[model samples]
Target: MFADARKIAELAWPVLIGQLAIIAFGVIDTAMVGRYSAVDLAALGLGSSIYISVYIGLTGILTALQPIAAQLHGARRYSEIGEEVRQSLWLALALMTIGFLILYFPGPVLRLARVPAALHERTLAYLQILAFGLPASLVFRVYSSLTNALGQPRLVMILQIGALLLKFPLNTWLIFGGLGVPALGGPGCALASITINWTLAIVGMLLLTKLDVFRELAIFSHFCWPVWRRQAAQLRLGIPMGLSYLIEVTSYTFMALFIARFGTTTLAGHQIAGNVGAVLYMTPLSIGIAASTLVAQALGAHRHEAARTLSRHGILMAVLIACCYALMLLVLRPLIIEGYTPNLQVAAAAMPLVLIVAFYHVFDSLQVTTAFVLRAYKVAVVPTVIYAVALWGVGLGGGYLLGFDVGGAIPVWLTGARGFWVANTASLAIAGFGLLIYWRGVSKRYLQVDAVGQVR
Candidate 1:
């Protein structure tokens, strides 16, 4: 158990760092744009919510490549790994087209939020520019996922840290205007993201071509047409995975949309709270990814017991770390929200939400780790149903009734963004427990099968 924990940490730390760097882009945008203009800040909040939903949904599909590649690497099937990479790229391109169209024509969805005219135009522009970067973003996701599954998270980490360094300068210049560049405000963040994403994609591909390890697999040696059988297999796993992500993200996405009705101050506050939650999520998410990679590889090698052990350790570590984080967040809630904006009202509005987010971290960690582990087992469909019922049905639906005070039963304290935050916290708890129970059942079944085979 101790040795397994170390292995998880060895792989998880780099992924944690890389994920933090990626998440910083949003944090920087929120803080910098919050200072630029309240309107821009609100637009940033709304625009990013929509963009994240689209991005996560699409990338979730590409993530199917991780387990497939990890298992292949463990089985020592080097050549087959290359073909999976090719098929994934094909899938990425197709998904990109769908994502791009949704982002480009975001008006229909934006209407659901009923964003005021002051924020709508800028939010629309933000989504449109992000649409231009969707393809590059998806391409880099393929690179990142492939590297991670092969136990090469450091490769992705280095690039992410580099992108973050670039992100600060670009965000500063484009957002506030400098070097003879006119300030683009909130939309500037989107522009900077596009530039950075494209750079990462191009350089990542170049590295794949030059890297000794990657070269061994000949990932780019030849272009093969999409194989329907492989594509179908990928989609079979990828679609539920994608929908699971979509359901989880859109639950929060809809929260932002519904909270928009409260006012810009409240919405901006929600963004701050949400961004902080995302930052804290990196640690557990990295652990989940590391464990998933190792588990998939172990299963591939027919070491089912090892895979089960790794999953158990990963969950234990994530929950413990999350508890520590939750305590720290509760203690520092005020100081943290202060950094996001100078507006007293916004900061005050975010206080309770951040307080709730502190505890939300624990449940968030639980659900995410279990979800990723389940994916490694190629058991996605059940989790998707769990998420949809828990996050969407429970989280979103409950938030609506509480936030809107449907029939006027909600308490005064729970009638606005507070209501939404409370509901989401509860929903995470539900989703986490549900996924954990399901994971245990799956593990038990796998062990039973192995035992029966051994007796035979």
Candidate 2:
């Protein structure tokens, strides 16, 4: 048990750091844009709310590559793993192309959302520019998943660092027009991201080709219909997992729409809180990824006992990290909000919301980590259903009833946000507990298989 715990921790730490860096990029981007104007910041926020639906929704489905690849690696099926990678590359390309088409037609969608006329143009521009990065982003995810599955998470960290480095200077140049280039304002950040993503994807592909295990498999040498079908099977397993993530993320996306209707200032505050929460969320998010990979690999090796043991330790570690994160948010809530926005009202409005988010992060951690593990077992449907119910039934439904339907003073609306958080936490707790139960049953079945010598 101790050995398994150590292995999980080793895998999770680098991933946790990489997640933090990704979050930091958002924070930096928000802070930089905030300096320009509150309207610019608001536009970025609203635009991002729409953009994230595509980014996370598609990436979530593609992320299934991690556990699938890890399981194959653990089973010593190197050739199959190579085939899976090739299929994932093609799958990512298709998804990215579809996403690009969607981005090109954002006017209809933005009009549907009924965003303020003033913010609409900027938001559309930002969305279009950001759309160009989708292909690179998807490709990067595939490479990152393959490397992590190979038990080398540090490569991801390095790749992320490289991307971030490029982002900072390019953002500065394009956003502010520093290098004899016309300032593109809010849209500039998206352009910078697109450039950085393509660079990372190309570099990641090169690095992947050089890996020892991948080289030995010669998966690059073969391309056939059978391999494509097998890869499609993995995607089928991943779709539910992807949908589960979409359900959760889309709930928040809809919530952002509701907040947008309130006013630009309100939307800006909401965006700040959301970005901060996303940054803090990196810790648990990375831990979940690590847990998923470890659990899948252990199961593939027919070490059901080890898989269960790793999950227990991973959950414990995740909870502890969540606690620390919540504590930091509590102590530095004001500083955190103030750092991002110069507008006094925006900062004040966002402060209370940050507190609500702090609480959400705790349970959010548990639910996400547990869900990742459940997906590794290919039991995604139940978790997806649970998420839909929680987000809509509790979080969104409760927020509407409390915030507006049962209207009152400003304090009441403020409290309503917290009520939404409470609903989210409750739903996450239920889902997390349910998954633990399901995992126990799966573990027992695997154990019986081992006893019957069917595992080998």
For candidate 1, write residues 360-439 as lDDT tens digits. 99999999999999888888999999889888888999999999999987899988998888889898999999999999
Candidate number achieving the greatest lDDT relative to the actual structure:
1
How high is the lDDT of residue 73 in model 2? 80
**Would you list the clashing residue pairs of candidate 2?**
none
**What's the CA error at residue 109 for candidate 2, in Å?**
0.6
* TM-scores for every candidate against the unseen true structure: 0.90, 0.88
lDDT of 2: 0.79
What would the per-residue lDDT of candidate 2 be over residues 130-168, giving only the tens digit for each residue? 888889899998888888888889999988877777777
Candidate 1 error regions (>4 Å):
31-43, 110-125, 172-188, 260-269, 334-351, 407-416
Residue 213 lDDT in candidate 1: 83
